[model samples]
Target: MAAAAADEADDSWMIAQEWMVWWDRPSWYVTIVNTRIDSIHRRKREENEENERVEGERREKKRAGTRGEQGEGESRRTTGDRATWRRQVKRRR
Candidate 1:
């Protein structure tokens, strides 16, 4: 008798689950597809933004390095002494 009752309870639960799935079946496919597409687009946008940020940082660093090298060359030409160059380097630090 207890086994029979448990079986009946399980059947009822399965019927309820089936009913819920049937009710949502009409729009479930479209909803799932749209959700997946939206997630893909969001990830792609985030990745592109990250790449752009890294590229911008790389460009800035490159420009700063070029300017520093140019300035050092000009200073060395104008000063024409190792001691003066050392002092300038210390001052920059």
Candidate 2:
């Protein structure tokens, strides 16, 4: 009975050591996740700034143009709109 108890204790100790070894290492998954999140945040910030600048320009154009159509409409259009319009035009022809 005492031998069996010793074996169980030994096994538990080995498991604890292994767990500690595994847990102590630097995790690539965590690093990758952090890097990806930071990259996404940076990209979103740049996109938001660009959008704000474009919106400011659009407002200025609206105020300045007497006929309300003198701005770069195609250049100011969103990427999705341009792609969708291209696809539709291609299909129509």
Best by TM-score: 1
Q: 57 in model 2: Cα distance from truth in Å?
A: 0.4
Query: lDDT per model, in order?
Result: 0.75, 0.78
Per-model TM-score on C-alpha atoms:
0.46, 0.43
lDDT of 2 at 60: 76
lDDT string for model 2 (40-92, tens) is 99999999999999999887775545333456542445556567888999999
lDDT of 1 by residue, 7-93 (tens): 999999999998898677768786887899999999999999999999997766555554444432232233235557779899999
Stretches of candidate 2 off by over 4 Å are 1-26, 66-93
Off by over 4 Å in 1: 1-25, 69-93
Q: What is the Cα-based lDDT of residue 92 in candidate 2? A: 100
